[model samples]
Every structure is written in structure tokens, then in C-alpha cells.
Target: MTLSLTELAACFEGVIPSILCTVGADGTPNISYLSHVTRLDDEHVGLSDQFFSKTARNIRENPRAALLVVNPHDGAQYRLDLQYCETVGSGPVFERMAADLRATSAQVGMTDVMRLRGVAIHRVLGLRAVRSPLAAAPPEAWRGSALPRMAAVVDAFADRTELGEIVDAALDALEAAFRHGATMILLHDPARDCFVTLGSRGYGRTGIGADVLPGEGLIGLSGKEGRAIRVSDASRLRRFGAAVEASSEQENRTRSVALPSLPGAMSQIALPMATQGRIRGVLFLESPKRLAFSAEDEAALALIARQLAAAIALSEADAAEAAPDAPIPRRPSEVASPHIRVVHHAHDDSVFIEHDYLIKGVPGRILIHMLEAFLSAGQVDFSNREIRTDRALRLPGLKDNLETRLLLLRRRLEDKNAPIRLLRLSRGRIRLHVAGYPIVISDRKSGAQ
Candidate 1:
């Protein structure tokens, strides 16, 4: 079969190191190792500039170079004849390379040493397979055109009525349309300036309510920079300060404190969701095999994220209504079982339950607010409008994510096995089931209440 550099896109995902052979002015050869290489297009590739002083000098004197890249999945190798194009010191290419290098550095514990100076773009003159006895495995099956699937996914969003249902529909469409193995959706927390996982699938740990600050990890970096972040070889980069705190009920609860990725994940792509010029959240997709996503996947998912963001924005207030009248049990009938001490630190919006940290940021503040309401009014059912209009929330954005924060707080409480429980009564109404745990609320500055 005829060979093309673009056909070997999997080999250029920067999962495995590549070799660069350059000719010096005197005809001597210099070889350098490349930590990262990305396919710029069908005819070009971008190589990360690291400690390649000699290779750079050789390339300058003689613009001819040979690149040897290997497919990490199948051990397939190819040699490409390259003609030096030019160096890109800034722009999108440089920024993506820098972000990826930071992930690589952290994987090898070289965050302080590795620095990206520029990206050396190269035009592929030709490509040929290296002779070997081991036969290369067949290439992965392509998902074909995403247009038809994208249409279906978008249509699914149009059919959903409730906000939570829309979130579920978005995830279902992603998995069904793209064939992505693991998928998750995170909501941006404006008050805390962080992203929290609200829903996820295809993970051992759902990581719901897990918080990611800007630049913390891949998901965090994506939300922080308001751009897409794609990484193959996710195993190494997965734990770079990325952990999901599992509920204490799980046997491996200790491991959950960190952010989580799909188990045995080799590739991941994070796309930021934006609506009306503001980033709302991020959509993360992962696969167990390497190079699971391509440029098409990235572009398609970005478009999907944009559409979903608008849907989410429109649905955020779908829950704003008066509390529904139902046969709600009286608080006095439900006798308290245990006393759970709760602390709210206003300084950082942190919450601790029974001396164990439960949640922080806006969600934490919301939890405290709920406890205060329960204590004062013996109220069990609360509506979205009530929470949104509450003077205590001080929600700091054009869009109030009261419902989303409630989703997060509920998940955190469930994971921690806290006595307090949040039960959804209807679209905009939630009933707090505080059985066996009487909450004692106290401010960070003042004494107990």
C-alpha cells in the first residue's frame, strides 16, 4: 500500500518518543530525541523544541531531515523525509505544545526542567514503512462521517425538558454519536473559579462533584484556558494532580480524593462549553486505546459542546418555580438519629461535616445555606427560585447555577455518606431528607449555633 504521513496520525500523537536525523553542514549526521510531535496537517508536522541545540544547528545548515515515529499501540514504525519549513515561536501551535509538554514533564517529574522554546514545523516530502519481521496490526476502524450523528445528538438536546435530563441527553449523544468509551460533563463554578464534575459515564469512579481549578490538569487546563485539550497516552498524564475523590463508602475511598480518568485510558480530549462568549463548562471524552480521537473528533466535539452550552444555559432556569405541593413528611415526625457537626468556612467557601471535608466553593456555601434554612424554619422542600433569590447565596454571575450547585452538593453528600440527603421532588423542587443526623451549623468566624 502507498504510504502517507497523514495515514500515520496515530504515530504522531506524542505518546512515544520520536527520533530526528539531521545532516550537518559538513555532512555529519546528528540524531535527537523528540518528546512530542503532532500532525499539523496532511503535508506537515510540528515538533516540540526542547534540548535540541545540535539538531537545530544541523537543520539550519541543511534543511533536510528524517523523522522516525512509532505507533505506541502496534509498534509500527515509519520514516518520513522532511523539508524544514519554519519555526513558530507563538500562536496556537506553540501554546498547545507548551501545555502538552507541561503534562509530559509532570509525568516524569520534570515540570521544573522542561521548557518549550518553539515549534519547528516540517513539510513531509515522503514516507516509507521500515522493514521489519513483525507485521503491523490493522488500523482502527474509523467512525465514518460525524455529520449524521451530530444531527441526531443535537436533536436529542432539543427534546429534553428538564435541566438534568438535558445533561443526560448530552452525554448519551456523545457516547452514541462518537463511540467514545468514557465521557463526562463538568459545570463551571463562577463563584469559586473552578469546574466541577456534574455527570460522568464509563468510569470506575464517577468523580461527580470533583473540583478542578484552572490549570490543575487536562480538564482544568481546558476550562482554565477556555480551549480544547487533547492527550493520548493518558496513563502517564492521568495522575498529574488529576484525581477524583470517591465517596468514603467505597472500599477504595482513600484513592478517590484525587481526580479520576477512565481506567486504562490511553487517549482523552476535553472541549470547553461556551455560551454567548463565556465558557460554561467542559466535555471530556476518553478511550482505553491510544489515539482514540482525531482532529475530526476534536472539531466535532467542540461544535457539540457549543450547542450543548446553549441548551444548558436555556435550561438553567427551567427549574425556577414555586415549591410543588405534595405529601411531604413533617420534620417533627422524623426524629433525629445522630448529631452531625457542620462547619462553613466563608473565607474559601469550604464545608466540613463531622470534621471531614465534604465540599468547598459555591456548592459548600449552598449546603450551609440549606442547613441554615432547615434549622430556622424546619423546612424540607426548597425550590430553585427560593435558592436563587436568597440574599445569603450572593451568587456572582449573570447566570445563576443554583440547580447545578444543588446537583453537586447532593452528589458530594451521597459520596461522603453524610446523614443529610437531597431528594428531587420535581423539576424545580427538592426535598431535604435529614434523618438520623441533626445538623449543627457554625460560621468560620463565630462560635456554634
Candidate 2:
């Protein structure tokens, strides 16, 4: 029986390297292992062209080539007869392949060594299954249609009006409805050119405020390319949890938060939450079982991610339309407490509450601004409109991401057990609650008692 590319989805996952065989003009055959084989369409596949000079030369001489791929689940093998089509230097396909290559290289600590030159497209002429002597693995049991569960998740997002609640609902749905226990949501910070961990579930630590650069890892690559990337067996890659632990040990000196991760995750997928041609964030999920997420699962997650992105965009729009509320007069504190030292480092806009790093970047700036207002005018209430338009804050224009930044600030304070808290009073309005008097210090030189 003939096998279609869609039926052999497991072989293209890059779990096991695919072998490419080509014949040179002198009739000399050369074989190379491919890092990735992206299925562009039903008739073509794109091979990652990085350090494949011999293969490229062979393709120039002869368009015919053979590829061998294996199904990671059942150890089933297939041979595909291919014809050289074209090499793409730049486009959506190349970018996706490049991002996937970069992520794979980072897994083995060879990110700098492996540089993608282009993606060589090949038309699949014919496909045939190779018989194996070993007994095949049993077929996986069906998990039922995910649409019903996914609909519930989407409905949950609709019910949330606040950015924080929407984020929480998405992560909660991943575990409660989809049975994906380990999940995280990282929002993109355009100013820093990185993604920040805003929400997470099923980790020992929340890792809120952690930063991940574009193309650094799976989560970063997904957001960088604005597409979904999945790994079937991650045991071959370096454990990211160890790196997080190592970074966590130096948290005091670096003031960097650790990224949450599963200790022995075998399968992982990072789905980009994109809307309006801009990537807002990434929804990352991991499981201990190999191939935990099927193609259907990825499609479902991608749909949910899109809905999440749209919901966040709508929430931001709603907040933007809300009129600034009149400031309320400050009331006397119910209890008297000792003063808490609040330090703001001007160099990076990082904030420290009594020597413990609370947050940095835009969120840090926002916190300092609110604290200054509280100290100078005894003002506790502020509006998103004020922060968005505050030239001093210098938030990104058009799509400032004010709501998420505020959420990060609020969560960071709660995580650090600080005396300061940010409470949402209404749409676009928030109140800063300080249990103890705050001693504001700026740039390590100036102080106000």
C-alpha cells in the first residue's frame, strides 16, 4: 500500500535524523544525515541546508535523490524517491526551518556552530515502506476528540475581562481540560527583544519575570518565528531544568529569575500566540511521555493560542477606551509598620525591595512611577491611560503592552512577598497598597525617607 506524507507525520518530527543519498556526476554516491525534513506540502519537503556542500553539489549534478526516514514510535522505516526542486534563501518556509534548526542546535549546545544557509526543497516522487525484522510497537490508544475540551478552554478565555485572569484561565485550561499539566505563558517584551514568563502552572516555582531571548530555545524560537514547534523525544537534548537551577543559584548576584521547566520532559510543544501580524507570546506545554502531543493536539493548541491572543488584544483595546478615573483622596493607614527600603537602579530600571530583586525593565519603571506618586502626593490610584501616555515611562508606542506589564509587576510583588501590592480597582484603574512606609532610593545615590 502507498503511504502519504500526512500518514507518516512522526518521521518528519526530527526525533531521529533522516538520511539523504545523492549521486555525483562521476556516479559517486554520497550520503548525509538531515537535521530536519519539513513537509512543505503533500508533494514536497524542505531539507535544512547547513554544511551540506557535498549534498548540494550532488543535487546540482543529479536531481534524483533518496531519503530514509524512521517512525520514532513503531521503528517503521520508509524510503522516499525525491527530485530536486529549488533552494529557498528567504521566505516564510526558510524562516520556519531556520528557527527550528536554531532551537535544535541550542538543545545540544551547538547553536553557534550550526548556521542555516537555506532550505532545499525536494519533490517527493514516490514513497515505499521498508520492512523491519523486529516486532512493531502497538498502536496508541485514542484520546477522543479534543474539540469539545478545546471549546471549553476557549469559552474560559471569553469569560475573563482582565489580562491576568485571561492568562490564568489559559494555563488552568491546559491542565484541567487538556490534561497538559506542565504549561507556561511568556509574553514578548519588544523593548528588551525577549519573552518574559508571565504565567505558569505545575512547576515548583512560578519563574515569573524570567527572560528568554529570541531563538534561544523552543519557547523563544516559537515566538521568534510566530509558529508552533514541537519535539517528540527531548531526552537527547540538554536538560533545560538544570540550566534554570544553575541560573537560580546566582539569582542574588544577577537578579535574573529562573525559567520554569519539567525535570524529565520527553515531549514538548511551544505554540505562538500571535495576532495582527505580531507575536504576543508563547504557550509552552511539556509531558514525560514521548509524542505526548500529536498533530491534532498541536492544531487544537494553535487554535486556542490564537483565541488567547485575540482575547488579550481585545482586553487591551477595552482598557485603552476606558476614561481615566478621578484620583481618590488618600486615606490613613489602618496599621503602623516599619519602613521598607525600595531601591530603583536607573541603569536597568530594576527594582529591589529591601535588597530582594522584585522586577526590572518597563514593569520596574512603572513601579517606581507609582511609588513616586504615592510618596509625593499620597496618591495610590493610577490608570492605564496615564501610564500608557506617560512620556517618562517610555512604553512602546501603538501596542504598549501596558496590561501585561502591570500583571507582571503585580505577580512579581506577590512572588517576592513584598509589602507593596497592586490591586485592580476597575478597567484600566489600579491602586497601590503598601503595608509599610516605603523609603524610596534612586540610582543607589539618592534617597527619600
Candidate 3:
């Protein structure tokens, strides 16, 4: 039976490294391990050009080459006879391979070492499966159409009116429908130039308010490039949590939250939530099993991310269009017995509740504004429109993204289990629920509260 290149899908996932054999003009054969092998089409494949000087030299001298790839699912092997084609330094194929390499290398702290110079395209002349003595194992039960489950997840987004609910639904759907237990949603903060974790699941700590700079890691790189990035096997990479613990501690000293991670995650994918060219956030998932996410999974998740981005944008617009509610008289707190110390650091707009870091940047500024209003006028309710138009807030012009900021602030407060809370009363209105009498302190210098 003739086997098509499509039948070797598992081999292209990079779960197991491939081997390339090439011959020089002198007829000397050279063999090397390949970090990536991308199936451009049924007859074409693209190999990453990194740390392959000898392979490159041989490929130039001899166009004929052989590639051996193994199936990560059942240890099946296939050898492909290839003819070297042109190398691409830039293009869709090159960019895709570069992104994947960057993501994988970043996982292993080899971002500088594993730089992609170009992609060597090759034509598949023939394919031959290696004979094995043992019988092949049956495919896993979960190996089937993901369309139905993907549809259900997309449908789950239909009725979510609030940004918070939408974010939660995305994470929950990933678990319920896709069986991806470890997931997180980090929203982009343009002013701060970073992504902040607003929602997460299946982690020991929520890692809410965690900050990831653009191009920092898999999540950041996906957001920076506005594309999906998947690393099928990260077993050799240093555990992200352990590698960054010291840095996280130092960042925490300056009020930065540590990123959440699964200790032994073997596979990871970061899908960008984007709409109309602007990235809104990132949908990140990781697993303990290698090759947990496939090409189809990435495509499906990309669609879901787009839907989520659009939904978030629509929700924000709807909130912005809401008519201002009639002014309500001040309502005094029923019980203001205990006092909670709220400190606002003017330098970075970081807010802390009784010395516990809560949040910073736009969300922090918004919280301080709300707390100040409550302190002065006993005002429990506020309107989004007023917040957006408030010159003191100095929110970004025209694209304030007030709704998302409020959602972040609300979630952070709840995550911290702080004394203050922001409850959405309607599309444009919210009420501040303070459990204790608040003493607001504003500091101009960078110092401990």
C-alpha cells in the first residue's frame, strides 16, 4: 500500500526529533538531528535551518537527502527520500517555522542559541515505513473529530455578556470540551505594555495580575506576533516555574505578579485573541502529555480565540454605549467596623491592601479613583462613562477599554480577597462593596507601605 505524507501527521508535530542524512560532493554522508520538520504540503516539507552548517553545506553540494521521522503516538517510523529545494529566509512558511522554533527555544532558555536563519524546503520523492516486529497499538480513544467539541465551546461564548464571564467561559470550555485542564487568559494592557493574567484554571495559585512582557515567553511571543504557537514536546526545557522563581521574587518586590505555570508541563500552546489586527489577549494551555495539541487543535483554538476577542470587543462597545443612569443619593455603609489600609503608590500606580500587593497600572489607578470617590462622598455606585471621561483618570483616548480594566480590577480584588469589591450593576454601572472602613494612603515615592 502506498502511504501518503498526510498519513504521517504525528511525525511533523516535533514531539520526537527527526534525522536528516545528506551527502557531500565527495560522497561522504552526514547525519544530524532536526528540531523541526514542517509539512508544507503532501509533496513538500520545510526543515528549520539552525545550527546545521554541515547539513546546509551538504544539501548545497547534493540535493538528494533522506529524512527519518517517528510517530510520537505509537513509535512508528517513516523514511522520506527528498530533493532539496530553495531556502526561504522570509515568507509565511519561514515565519511559521520561526515562531514555532522561537516558542520552543524560549521554553528551554535557548532563545539566543536556537535562532532560525532560514527554512530549507524540500520535495518528497518517496516514503517508506519501517517494518517493526511488534504489533502496532490502537489509537487513543480521544483521537477523533474535535469539531463537535469545538462548536460547543464556541456556543458557550454566545451568551456571555460580561468580559469576566467570557474569559471564565473560555477557560472552562477548554477544560470541559477539550479536556485541557491547565488554562489561562491574559488580557493586553497597552499602557503598561504587558499582558496581565485575569482568569485561570487548574493551578495551585490563580496567578491573577501576573505580568508577561511582549516577546518574553510563549504567551508573550504569541501576543506579540498575533499568532498561535505550540510546543509539542518540552521535556528537555527547564521548568518555567523553577527557572523564574528568583526573578519572580525580585519582580514581586516591585509589585509584579508571578506568572502561573504547570510544574511538569510537556506540551504548551499560546493562542492570540485578536480582532481586526489588534491583539486583545492570549489563550494559553499546557499539558503533562507530549503532543497534546495538534495542528487541528491549534486551528480550532485560533477560531475560538477570534470569537472570544470579538465578543470582548462587542461587550466593551455595548458598555460604552450604555446611557448613564440617574444619579442616586449616597448610601452609608451598614457596618464599617474594621478598617482596612489601602495604599496607592503613585510611581507605578500599584495598590496594596494592608501590605498585600493587589494590582497595578490602569487597574490600580481605577481602583484608587473609586476608593477616593467612596471616601469623599460615600458614593457606592459609579458609571463607566464618567470614568472614561474623567480627566484625572487619564485613560487612553478613544480606546479607553474601560470595561476590560474594570473586569481586571474586579477580578484582582476578588482574587486577593480584599476588603473592596466592584460589582457590575448593569452595562455601564457598578457598585463598590467595601467590607471594612477604608483608610486611603497615597505615596509619591517608591517605598514599602
lDDT at residue 177 of model 1 (Cα atoms) = 80
lDDT of 3 by residue, 1-449 (tens): 99999999889988889999999999999999986899999999999877368878898888999999999888898999999889899989998898888887777778788878899999999999988898777666676777877898889877988788888887888888777659988888889888888889988788887878888788888899888988878888764555555243455486877787787888888999999889999999988888888888889889988998899999999889784667645676554869998889888888888877888888899888988888877888888888888899889778777888898889878877787899888888899999888988887533545
Residue 338's lDDT within candidate 2 is 86
* Candidate 3 colliding pairs, count: 0
Comparing 1 with 2 on lDDT, the higher-scoring candidate is 2
Native-vs-model 2 lDDT? 0.85
Number of clashing residue pairs, candidate 2: 0
TM-score of each: 0.84, 0.87, 0.93
Per-model CA lDDT versus the true structure: 0.77, 0.85, 0.84
- Tens-digit lDDT track for model 2 on 174-205? 78876755999898888888999999998888
RMSD list, candidates in order: 4.0, 3.2, 2.4
Error of 2 at 344 (Å): 1.8
Among residues 3 or more apart in sequence or in different chains, the pairs in candidate 3 whose N, CA or C atoms overlap within 3 Å are none
Q: Where in model 2 is the C-alpha error above 4 Å?
A: 21-31, 49-65, 82-96, 109-112, 118-125, 239-242, 246-249, 323-325, 333-335, 386-398, 444-449
On TM-score, who's better, 1 or 2? 2
